[model samples]
Target: MTTTVGRISLAVQLLCRAGVRVLAVAGSANQNWLASLGAEPVVYGDGLEERLRTRAPNGVDASIDAFGDGYVELAIKLGVAPVRINTVVGFLGARRFGTRSDGGMAAATAEVLAELAAMIAAGELIVEISATFPVEQVREAYAKLAERHTRGKIALRMR
Candidate 1:
């Protein structure tokens, strides 16, 4: 399951393209958008485990938690192996549960970046740009990012 914002859109796209059935856990506002990208969006909050079970009766193959709040445990509880579970914001959870906390670093190879860039250029991938601010507006850009509801990257344009 994934969060509403962050790199969830790209994750969903990549997973869907790989023939994996993506069950995206997002906020209500992003549910429809996630669905349009071939994911079954489940609203995140209380009883998320039950909701996820209802969607994937057989169980999930793996899980990635971008908004870590006990999600590492939740993924383990959902039957995902520790090695297959990765969290971007759950370093403690990763250490405690032996899960991977390797986020961008693990997947940021030049070849991978080139592939993603090619997909974006070929219209096979979509990178949602939540907002763009001039370099002078760095503070304002961070303020917007701090709100935590941006759909994607809040770019700081170098002007």
Candidate 2:
């Protein structure tokens, strides 16, 4: 969760906070919801490239690869500079493509965390949860995550 999908979610929030336009690549289930968060939605899979181009006709300024599996390459193909691309999951791809292989470390800081918390507290940043599991159900929690269809974070409760 350091700089993976979790980090991508935060990055999106940061962008929205800064008023930067975002093109979020999500599945049909989450597309509208992502749009509600201020990101223009680009559905993942078939026609992804075309959709991205259509959404950002002026060209993408940067990229964040959370799901890996050739996205680093896709971002490169879309004309984003290697230095502007940061990835968490596509380590090998980042190395190969010369993209920054950071786990969202550039955006991490105590002040930022406090700001994010405030955003949530103020409802400025929408926090979606796919599931909530007790600490004892950690296995079940992980199983749900492995399904790869969650639209938001899954919570694990200590109690």
| Worst 10 contiguous positions by lDDT, candidate 1 | 1-10
Q: List the residue pairs that clash in candidate 1.
A: none
Clashing pairs in 2: none
lDDT string, candidate 1, 1-159, tens digits: 432222378888888887778888878998888888888888888988899888888887788878887888888888888988888888899999999888757789999999999999999998989999999999999999878778888998887
Local distance difference test, candidate 1: 0.82
Q: Point out where model 2 deviates above 4 Å.
A: 1-7
Top candidate when judged by lDDT against the true structure: 1
Please, what is the whole-model Cα lDDT of each candidate in the order they appear?
0.82, 0.76
As a TM-score, model 2 comes out at 0.88
Per-candidate alpha-carbon RMSD to the true structure: 2.5, 3.9
